[model samples]
Target: MAPLVWLITGCSSGFGAQLVHSAVARGDKVIETGRNAATKLKHLEGTGAAIVDLDVSLPEADVKRIVDEAVKIYGKIDVLVNNAGYGINDDYRKLFNVNVFGALSVTRAVLPYMRAQQSGTIAFVGSMYAWWAPALLSVYGAAKGALRAIAESLAAEVAPFNIRAIDFEPGFFKTPLTDMAKIAQYAPTAQPVDAYAGHRAAMGGLAQALIGNERGDVKKGVELMVDVIRGEGSASGRKIPQRLPIGEDAVRVVEGTCKNALKVIDVWRDDVVGTTDRDGFEGEKDYEAIVKGPDAQV
Candidate 1:
């Protein structure tokens, strides 16, 4: 088989950094992008990985330049990983700007090529928080939730073109990106209240609990992603695995939450399926009349 070509954004640190290294280690050609490409991920150049400066939050035209550069150097891209994201503790608008819009911008930029080839894979580094309700991480979860929804819908839309979308839902992985000091601005603030007087306090407590309980290893996390990329594991999809939960904790959360949510869904599953048209009538014309209204003009 020919070596796979990968284009990954947010190569500065965390899973993006590890993924870039892992892909290069496996003899795959990698093109990594960062807002500051020279300083962050420049180390990958020593491993023969191409580094490109790309801001996923930029306009489509700018993103096109990045994609064009990748195609120019690599001939073709086999995988596109949407990984450029940051967490804001308070400035959720900023977080959404990067995590949600930024990711979509990059995804859209590379999609035309992937669609034309009809044989490429797009993986999103979604969070377990997207599936599970982790308190105090609402903004981050919301952004990831958007990505998850997009992946699920895009999976169906792109299947006809033979393009696969996968969501890598990983639990917390140890990385500098997790620094509370750095991401403090993204956290919610306290305000005087009487009704929900302790809400902010409760949120802080939850954050502490997560810090104490969550188990994440950068090496292990990246290895799981590599396995999925190589198709060496049993976690396969019918068309494509729309979502792959990495780490034991991630799998546990998905299974548990889904079990509970499934019960609720099972109860109302029939209600969700539209059985009849809104216009319940004796004839097609009658239905049309009902829809249009009797006294209304066409």
Candidate 2:
């Protein structure tokens, strides 16, 4: 197979950095973008990867420029990794702007090229919190949840074009992104609330402990990702999961959430079914009929 061209966002650190290394090691061409690409990513300059200065939080025009540059350099992008995101404490707007909207913008910019080519893979670096929210991390989790929702819908929409959407749910990885000093700078000052004091303390403790001691290995995770993208190695002959959990903790969280959700649905099955009016009542059934009718818009 010919070497693939990869365009990855947030390449300064964490999964993005590891992914760049892995991709380059496999002889794949990479366009690595980060806010501090000139300095932070300087070490990768002679590694045959093009470095682009890109801040995902920037406007659409900036994102388009980055995409254009990537295409110009690599001819085409075979894969796109949206990996720029940060956790903010209680600041939902800020979190949503960078993690959700920024990623969406980058994906949108890359989609036209991928669609024209009729083949590409877009991987989103999401988190386990997207599935199971932990204390004090609700804002971050909500942003990731939105990203997951976008990836799910996008997979169906672009299937005909052979463009694949994948979401990587990572759990507790030790990286600069999880550094306490950096997190504290990005995180808003915690407000004193009597009722949630204990929960807040517990969350703080978890963050501190996991900062430099996370169990997930970045190198191994990126290796799996590369294999999955190539449709060989460990992922050969297996259906690619739309949501790929990257660690033991992520797997547990996703499975546990699914199990608990199913249990709830089972418990409420009778009541849920009873909501429909059975006796020729115009309800959701009528709506379904209309939706399934010939007049329904595509």
What are the C-alpha RMSDs, in order, of all predicted structures? 7.5, 4.3
Clashing pairs in 2: none
lDDT of 2 at 68: 84
**Looking at candidate 2, what is the lDDT of residue 51?**
89
Q: Would you list the C-alpha lDDT of every candidate in the order shown?
A: 0.78, 0.84
Q: How many clashes (backbone N, Cα, C below 3 Å) per candidate?
A: 7, 0
**Candidate 1: TM-score?**
0.82
What are the runs in model 1 whose C-alpha is more than 4 Å off? 185-197, 209-213, 233-239, 265-298
Global CA lDDT of candidate 1, please?
A: 0.78
Per-residue lDDT of candidate 1, residues 168-214 (tens digit) = 89886776656666556544475535665476579667566766355
Model number with the top TM-score: 2
Pairs that collide in candidate 1 are 88-186, 89-185, 89-186, 89-187, 90-185, 90-186, 90-187
